[model samples]
Target: MHPRAGQTKKRTRIQAKNEAKILEAALDIFATFGFRGTTIDQIAQKAEMSKPNLLYYFRRKEDIYISVLERTLDEWLTPLTELDPDGDPIEEIGKYTSLKLKMSQNDPTASRLFANEILHGAPMIEHVLKGSLKNLVDEKAAVIHHWVKAGKLTKVDPYHLIFMIWATTQHYADFKIQMRAILGDDVDQPDYYEKAGQTISTVFFEGIKPR
Candidate 1:
């Protein structure tokens, strides 16, 4: 028999400072260097722990990276899942804008880590992309289809819409040095996310909202 979803999926907890510190260090380390390039020793040093102690929680560098991704992906896709199929399209879009911007601003490390994974062709996470990520995309595409059919939003390729969202939101994180040099250091200021959110939201909602 197939295992139940709840049974198969376990959650993470940051019950203590050390665990949180470890994860924070792991996130920064993985983001700075791609998975193949990061080392357990580096992570341990960053977290102020010995390699053996870090290994107590995460067996390998891959495990730590996956943990960070799991936590980040869960938070990242939340805005989509929060969209109320029955609610106003404009409102949902606004909420998504803020949520996505917050991820870009507050969790740039997580974003870079994910970007690094995909840039290298996602050898470790292709399975996840094919499975859970693909499933969620298909499900949301169905909702977006209804909006288009009902004349609530513009008719656009749903897959490409998703891709646009990911690409636009992740650009600052993935291309930090270039973006900073071009836009100035304040590109990451708090207002930066607000401005980005508002700009993207306006551009999208204006184009899509039943005109």
Candidate 2:
């Protein structure tokens, strides 16, 4: 989905690697400086490539920015997409919660990048938010509804439940500085996220488990 079109041929290993490198550098730049503050030259420098070489893969800064956001969105949604309706509702939700927290712990940059995009009105990725994201969330919400009706969960708004999970899990990434300030550097430790997942699951399941 990167490299200016027109080739109509499969990318070589080198081409694929170069594109990945560009996206990786662009993510760091965009996440730190944001879209407006970031520039093609900055990404090229970050990638340790000449500007011309970088442009060979991505013609415009906007192209690189959109690609990064698209990739991040796919990754950010993967945990929810994995939720299985056929599984035990509480267990499934707990697994989803843990996976989401793991993502924040492992790749907080991606989470912050995405959160910043939304804060600015998601000007670049609104279509995706409306289409693919909406469809996926709706499908999962229906699954949650099914669980509730089947007496697996207490009556609750599926959309809000999903939103609550997102808010709570993502807080570790979006407000990491605040977290680190209050909780200290231990916030970066694996056990911290594990404990967070356990605490969140306990609180959520306690409220939602069929009473």
Model 2: per-residue lDDT, tens digit, 1-211? 6545757878879899999999999998898778888989999998989999998898888889999998888888888999999999988998898888888888888988988888889999899899999999999999999999998998999999999989998898889899899999898788988888878887887754566
TM-score of every candidate: 0.83, 0.91
lDDT of each: 0.78, 0.89
Give the range of the ten consecutive residues with the poorest summed lDDT in model 1. Answer: 1-10
Residue pairs with clashing backbones, model 1: none
Error of 1 at 114 (Å): 0.9
Q: What is the lDDT of candidate 2?
A: 0.89
lDDT of 1 by residue, 8-28 (tens): 554344325666788889889
After superposition on all C-alphas, the RMSD of every candidate to the true structure, in Å, is: 5.6, 2.8
Cα TM-score of candidate 1: 0.83
